[model samples]
Target: MKGLTLDAALARLLIVVLMALTLLPFLSMFSAALAPSGSYPPGLAWPADPQWANFAKAFEVAKMDELLLSSLLIVVGTVPLSVLFATMAGYGLAKFDKGRGRWFYLVFVLGLTLPFEAVITPLYYEIKALGLLNTRFAIILPLIGLYMPFGVYWMRTHFVNTPKELSEAAQIDGASEWKQFWLVHVPLARPAIMSLAILQFLWTWNQFLLPVVLVQDPLQRTMAGALGAFQGQWGTDIPLLCAGALLILAPTIAIFLIFQRQFVAALLQGAVKG
Candidate 1:
């Protein structure tokens, strides 16, 4: 009992330490952002007179309003279609993992091995050929395609592990395959689907390379992608740059904090089931 108690206490201490390490950088950045514009901060100390207006100034100068709109549009275009297709594909693969279906699943699994950098050049050319370069579709389409492998894998794991009796019972009740998928499995897979949506949203929001390479106009690119331009123009202003960075990061952080419970629950559910 004493040994187990000691181990638990040690684990708690480690977790607290890790959490502090993770948050330290954010704390430092926040402190730096509150310092006067164009002034170099001294280490991680908070300013005597915090320049809270720096955030507002950064937002306006960065044209974050437009960037926010562009990001929302891309996310809207990307996440839903990606989730739907991945869910359907995953269900199909789970339901019919034989012969050609096995090959199809293998193809998707192979896609998982492909790194974004490896295919990005070819992807750029393809987008250009299709006249999608520098357009929202350029980022949106590629993101959906890129997200497919993992999204499908996540959903397939959920569907495969589901009790066969559920599908069988649905079939016995005169439910069509489509009905079974829509009415039965999808409802049960809500947590997995929600988790996948949250992940895809985060990825789509933070995507830098694709937006940078495929889209030329900074205004057309994601907020993070446009950060390159913002940094280049304001590289000398440390506090302002930090403020801009914090602004760019704020939305994702807000989203994660709000949905953290669902994210954690989904993960825990997967863990228990798996």
Candidate 2:
């Protein structure tokens, strides 16, 4: 009992230290945002009079309304389609013939190893050739393809771990493969799907490189991607820059907080299976 108590105390202490380390930068940014615009605030120093107008200024100056709308459009375009196709591919790979499925699954796993930097140059030329440059499709199409490897792998894990008896029972009842997938497997995959959607939403929303590279228009790029231009234009306005940064981060933080339980649960489920 004493040993267990001591170990628990140590674990909590470690967690507190880690949390502080993680939150330090955010705290500093928030402090900086509250400082007067055009003033360079020192690190972690709280302003005597918080400049609440800085957020408003950042929003207006950065054209956050447009950025948010563009981000929403991209997320809507990418997440559902990516999730649908990944779910189908994952289901097929999990339940289909062993030999062929294994090979196909290997191809997706190979995709996981291919980094963005490696493919960005070739991807640029291809998108240009297709006349997608500077268009939303430029960002949307590439994101869908980029997300597939992990999306398929994630959903496949869920399907593989699920009991085959459910699928078998549905088939015995005269359900077609499509019906069995939609009715039986999909409902069972609610947690995994929810988690996948959240991950993809965050990824799509926070996506910077692809949007910056593929889409030439700042108005068409994701909020994070547009930040590069925002910084260049208002780089010297420290408080306003910090405010914009916080705005970009707000949605992702809110999403994680809201769905953190499902996210953690899916992670544990996958970890246990592995």
Candidate 3:
């Protein structure tokens, strides 16, 4: 009884500490964003009147609709490419044995550890050389490449979990390789693919440095880039920045919340099977 009581107390204390740490900045930001705009609040007190319209003002000034559309386009293009490439690569790696498999596997795994910063310089030149700079495709193409190794690894793991017998059975039938991949494999991979898509989408949506470095045209840039530009232009207003952040964060947050149950289940299922 004594030990159980102590453990409960510790758990409660840890939770309190964590909640405080997590909520403090947000609470401060909320208060600051609302507290009449001139100075910080007197203490930990929230704003007497939270100016919700600050958000609208931010939207008006920032051309948020355009920013969001740009982000949407990048995400739309990148997600499918990443998934298709990764899935095909992963499936091939898992299913097909060319005997040089170990070398390819090592190289693919090595890609996960390669830092984006290290490749940025070379990537910039490559994009520029291809005459793709200031275009969204420049960012999209690199993202797909960067996503490929991990995507392949993720799908490959899932594919391995799927018994070899499934594919062999399909092959023993008259089904072509493409048909088997599309019909038999793709359906089974829904969970693994969904999990990877959510992860990749969030990463791509929030991507900053790559877009910042590669994109020179403001309208062509993503929401993250636009936010950076927003800061440069109207940073004196904290409320506006917060408001813009809220707008920027809204769609992904809403999507995650809507699919929270599925996301959790998919992650757990993939972990268990893979």
**Number of the predicted model whose lDDT against the real structure is largest:** 1
Query: What's each prediction's TM-score?
Result: 0.95, 0.97, 0.89
Candidate 1 lDDT (Cα, 0 to 1): 0.93
lDDT by residue (226-247, candidate 3, tens digit) is 7788888867767767777777
Candidate 2 or 1, higher lDDT? 1
Give the alpha-carbon lDDT of every model: 0.93, 0.92, 0.83
Pick the winner on TM-score between candidates 1 and 3. Answer: 1
Off by over 4 Å in 1: 1-4, 269-274
Least accurate 10 contiguous residues by lDDT in model 3: 35-44
Relative to the true structure, candidate 2 reaches a TM of 0.97
Instruction: Give the alpha carbon lDDT tens digit for every residue of 74-134 in model 2.
Output: 9999999999999999999999739989999999999999998999999999999999899
Root-mean-square deviation per candidate: 1.9, 1.6, 2.7
Q: Candidate 3: deviation at residue 242, Å?
A: 1.6
Q: List the lowest-lDDT window of 10 residues for candidate 1.
A: 265-274
The residue-by-residue lDDT of candidate 1 on 1-274, one tens digit each, is: 3557887988988999999999999999999999998899987898999999999999999999999999999999999999999999999999997899889888998999999999999999999999988999999999999999988888888898989999889989999999999999999999899999998899999999999999889999999999999999999998999999999999999999999988887678667754
Candidate 1 residue pairs in backbone clash: none
